[model samples]
Structure formats: C-alpha cells, structure tokens
Target: MINVRSREFAVPFLQRLIQVDTCNPPGNEHKLSVLLQDVLRETGIASSIKSVEQGRSNLEAVITGPGSRKLMFCGHLDTVSPWTTAAGRYPPHGAVIEGNRMYGRGTSDMKSGLAAMLLAAASLHQDGIRLAGDLIFLATAGEEVDSCGARLYADQSSLAVLDGIVIGEPTGSRVAVGHKGALWLRISLFGRSAHGSMPQLGLNAVEGMMEVISLLHRHALEWQEHDPVLGSSSLSVNKITGGVQTNVVPDHCTIDVDIRTVPPLQHGPLRREIEARLQEIQQLHPDYRYQVEQLLDRGVVYTDPAQRLITTALEIAARQGGAGDAILQVQGVPYYTDGSVLHDNGRLPVLIYGPGDHRLAHQPDEWVDIDDYLASIDFYRELAIRFLGTAEE
Candidate 1:
C-alpha cells in the first residue's frame, strides 16, 4: 500500500495528478482515474471507475472496515478552463515546492483534498486497526459543469446504505454546512416585425424585452430580504440576444436570467411571482407576448447541525483548536455543486469543507494555498476518527 505517513508519497501523487490536463469542456479525466486505480491497487484497496460519458469519469475506492456505519469522502477531478496566458492555471507544470507552499491549479480547489484522502486511506498505520465504519473515497467529475457525475453516483442503490457524505470543496479549512439552490430561466419576447422606415406599423420586440427586463430589475430589488447566514436571494440577466438587422423591427428577443434561492425562498412561488410580474408588464403593452422556460432547476440543501456527522465535525474541530465552530453555521455560495443533488436526493447528512481560496476558482491565475490543502487533510482525518472511533475496526 502507498505510505501516507511520509510527505514523500503525497508530494509525488499530487504532482502527477496536477500534470494531467483534466480541464473541462471536454473534461477527459480517465487518465487521472487510471492513475488513482493503480494507487489503490498497490495499497490493497479495491476500486472502480464509473461514468456517464467515456473519458468523463468518476473514481471510487472503498476501505472496508468492521463497522455498520458507512461514510463517503468525495472530491472533483476536473478544473476550469486553463489560464489564457502561457503561465498555466496550475502554475509551474507539476508540483513546485517553495518555502511553505506547493503552487498548482487544483491544489486548493480539490486535487489536494483528493490526494490527502487517498494518503489517509493508504497510510493508516495500525496493523489490526479497523474503522468503526466503512470509508468510501470517490473522485467525481463534472462538478464544475452540470454535476452529472454526482447525480449518477447518488442514483446508485449502494449509496443508499451510507450514513452520510462529506464533500471536499474549498472552504478554507471550515466545515461548510449548506449552500443555496439555483435555477436558470430563459425568457423569450415575441412581437411583429416590419420595415424600420414604417416604425409606427410594427410592434417593437426590443421595447417589449426592455420592459420585461425593467420589471425584473424592480422585482429583484424587492427580494433583498437577507438571511443571517445565506445572505439574500439574487437574480441577474446574464444573456440577451435579439434583432437581425438595423432596418428590420425584430420579431423576437430572448433574455436568460440566473436566480439563486435560499431557504424561505421557495422555487415554485418564486417562479409564479416572476410570471405574474411579466404578465403585469404585458398588460401595459398589448402587443407584447412572452414565455419563460426553465433550463435547469436544483433544490436547496439544508441539514440539521444536530446530526451525528455534523456533531462529530464540530467536536473534531474543537479538538483541533476551535477549527470546528465554522461547521455550526450555514453559508451561501453563488455557484452550485453536486452537494445539492446528493443532499436533495439521498436525504443523507452532507457537509462541504476543504482548502483553497474561492476567489481563484475558474480564474486565469487560479491556484490554491499549500498550507490549506494539508490542513484539510488533517481536519478530515480527525473528523473521521471522532465519528468511527479507533476501537470498532
């Protein structure tokens, strides 16, 4: 088995993972999957890779212990678009150790999280030491896109028996309890088209679109009620496209809106309210016609801090010098992840914690701190021991 005790094994493992260009858009993660499989095999852990699409894969390695409770540790293998400049997103190619930091793309975002977990599984030194529970290490794909790989895993009947899930997202060493839900809406405005010369003879589709947009702007302002932790629900028009030519009155215009919802902000009601507002605007402009289509809908994820997993995390954090207090509070994030799908469908206790600065995510100079990555490893390892205990296995 790969030794987790020394920094030697982890350094090389992480460096190799970074070297593999698994940047998404075509996210070919099979290369990394194969490497992980090889590591698991050497460590005497049986593993497998599952995928919805070829090359776009998820890796799962199970450490069977002597307990009934099963816990899963998940991390994503894909990175965002590479840096525009030749400098590289993950930085100086493989792992570059300078002082206290190991610079790289997926370091903070998650490759480091995955590496640490892998090392933990490979390095547990107790010869007869068995865990109080089963540990499942899963490196899922498409977390940066549609969460397709996570959905696939959640749907597996085997996952139903698990006690809970711990998602290794970059939370700067804090235990993130919850995140907001998301919905993508596309609104199309329809109107009559005629020659620009005879402006009075044609209904202006652009005007209809402008009115709808204005109404939404006002409506969004009305939703500014903030939650102490989740902050506030938000709506923004991200895309708008319409007219064909300057001379012709456009027949159609379409605008895409992104909405983030928190608890107390139900999706169905939110949608109904939006439609009502659109109808009100249409009433003032008789010639305007519009339709709203939902491109994607994901429910919000909320868990009780009293759950065993959350409690264990808090206790462990405390033992690690008050690092656990962050686990007690819920926070809102602008983006969505597989956590949403898993929490909603699995009905299992879920928490997000990891290393890396979120500001660097998907950016050109994206990189994670070396210290944060190592800290997350220790945090999760302690969290596991607290819950499973040393005696059971």
Candidate 2:
C-alpha cells in the first residue's frame, strides 16, 4: 500500500514533473512514467505501468474510497512535439515564474491538468475523504500521436467496467461534453510513366489523382451535414506526393486526407461513401486506376445533455465558479485526441475540462497561468468530492 501526502506536498511534486521533458516523435516517456510512479507512491496511490508498444506506456493508479460507484480521471502523459523556437527541448528553457504566469512546454497543452489530477488524488487520500465511489487516475501515452494509450486502456477488461470518466484536456473551466472524430485516408493513383518532354506519351498519375481530389472537393458539398454541437464534417487534403523529377510525368501519385466527422456520422458508412465516390469517378474515367485505404479511424464523441456524469460536472463547476449553466458544447477541433476514443468506444460519460490556451499548446512561448492551474485543480478536486461523495473510512 502506498502512503499519500497533502496538497502542499503534491503541488511541488507536480511542478518538478513539469520540469521533466517528455516530448513525443521519439517520445521518451518511460522515464517520466517511472517518475510518476514514485510521486503517486508518495501518496499511497498504488500504480502500475502498462504498455502495448515499448517505450510508450500508460500509468494507472487508484485510491479506494467507500463505494461501488467508480469515478475515473484520465490525462495523457505524452506531449506534442516541442516548438522549433529558441526554448529548445532540454531544460524546457523558459519554465520561469514571471509574476503570475508559468511558462513552459506541456505546461498548457497540459501538464497542468495532469498535475491537477495527481494533486487531487493525494489531497483526497491524505484527508481520508470518504466517497461514493473508487477514484481512478490514468495518465496515458501516445495521445498526441494515434490514441494508442486510450485504445489500449479502454480494451482492458478492468477499464471497461468503470462507471464514468473525466478527461483533463484544457477546456478553460467549462464542462465540455463532446468532440469531433477523425479519419485519416491515403488515396493512391497509378498511371503509365512517360518522359517529361513527351507530355502526352505517358499517362499522368498526378492529373488522375487531382481529378479524384476535385471529385472529393465536389463531394464535400454533399457531405456538409451538421449537428447541433459538432457542426459540419470537414475534409482536408493535407499531403500529396508524386513524380520523381521535374521533367518526368510521374506514373504514381498519392494523397493523404483528413476527415473530421460529427457524432451522428460513423466511420463504416462514411468510408463506404468515399469509396463509392471514387468508384463513380473510376467508372467515368475508365483509364484511371486508384485505391483508397484507411490510415487511421477514430469515432466521434458526445454525451447526452442529461447524462448524470456531465450534469454532475456542470453543477460542480457552476457552484464552485458561480457560473450556473457552465456546459461547453464545441464544434470541430483541427486535431484528434483520446477523448473521442473513450466516449465513443468505452461508452462512458466523459468530459474535458482543464486549464490553458489551445493555441499556445505547441508554440514557442507555450505556458499556463499558475492561477488557472491551481483553480482547475480546485475545480477537479471538488468534482471528485461530489462524485465520490465524502470518502467514508
């Protein structure tokens, strides 16, 4: 059994954690996971590290209270790539306190939220607070990449049994109940290779691929359906590669696409639709040869407005912040996160509320307001108290 500590002890520990650099892309997260295990142990929060991929790991800890109802707090331990700016990676350069602000990478994109969860668990455990349910803390890895951590955790038999989940992604104090989903596709086209000088001799795969892109652009008009919360689905042709030399009319071209979907739209049908559209184009231009394959698929997420978990979080935020109707419903986010994976597959009521500006997440001057970090911890702690009730020893 691990022994827990007070809030004061937890805070400095979190700061020291923020002091560690665990940036992804060759995400060196094991060392940090070990550090977290040490910190969590200090508060009697026993934890275990699980991994599907070597080096990338997820950490889980639990504080048993006095109830059958279970409440889970989850945040990613792996951070996005650091800024290519002056701050650099080592020492995380500017993690200084300029009066009220705390400047550093992962500080906002959210080491702050991660810190809050740790402190909350320690504080609640040390106080011997009684609860309505067991409290689970999950710090996952590879969230900034594919949702490998969330997917692995959710697939666990134990995680599937949880009653509810709260994902600490920066929502700036509002109770965010939903997020859009993402599908990554790669479209490849084939054509006869010909010398650049003889333009018409060989088929131009680049043009054939562009034709498909044009069709996709036209198809976007038909796909522009919207929902009350997640708005319209979006398509972005982010990357295209073909042709080896400036002079040659390349025989192959491939395009990478990103598709964002709202809740009502599932991936199976959407994928079929895309394939159908491509097939239609193929029929129209029999000479064209192409194939479409999924690179990544993530489902959309939205809790019913009346869900008990969401309502509880809103009420807690409202009472503590004096903002009654503090439910935040948002549309498409440019990128994807594990929140959607947890909500869509785990089928657990999930919300993302934390501290920091989304824009500064990976920026050079990335930082979080110290007050915001502390306040978010307070809010989450109150939420734990409410959901877990008063911990009964």
Residue 304 CA displacement from its true place in model 1, Å: 1.9
Clashing pairs in 1: 1-43, 90-105, 130-393
TM-score of 1: 0.87
- Report the error of model 1 at residue 381, Å: 1.9
TM-score of structure candidate 2: 0.89
Q: Which ten residues in a row have the lowest lDDT in candidate 1?
A: 120-129
Error of 2 at 275 (Å): 1.3
Q: Write the per-residue lDDT of candidate 2 for residues 90-198, one digit (tens) a residue.
A: 3453466666777777887778888887777777777667666888888888788777788898788465567788877776766776777888899998888888999
For model 2, the stretches where C-alpha displacement exceeds 4 angstroms are 1-15, 86-94, 324-335, 344-346
TM-scores across all candidates?
0.87, 0.89
Tell me how candidate 2 scores on lDDT.
Answer: 0.76
Best by lDDT: 2
Global Cα lDDT for candidate 1: 0.75
The C-alpha RMSD of each candidate to the native structure, in angstroms, is 3.1, 3.2
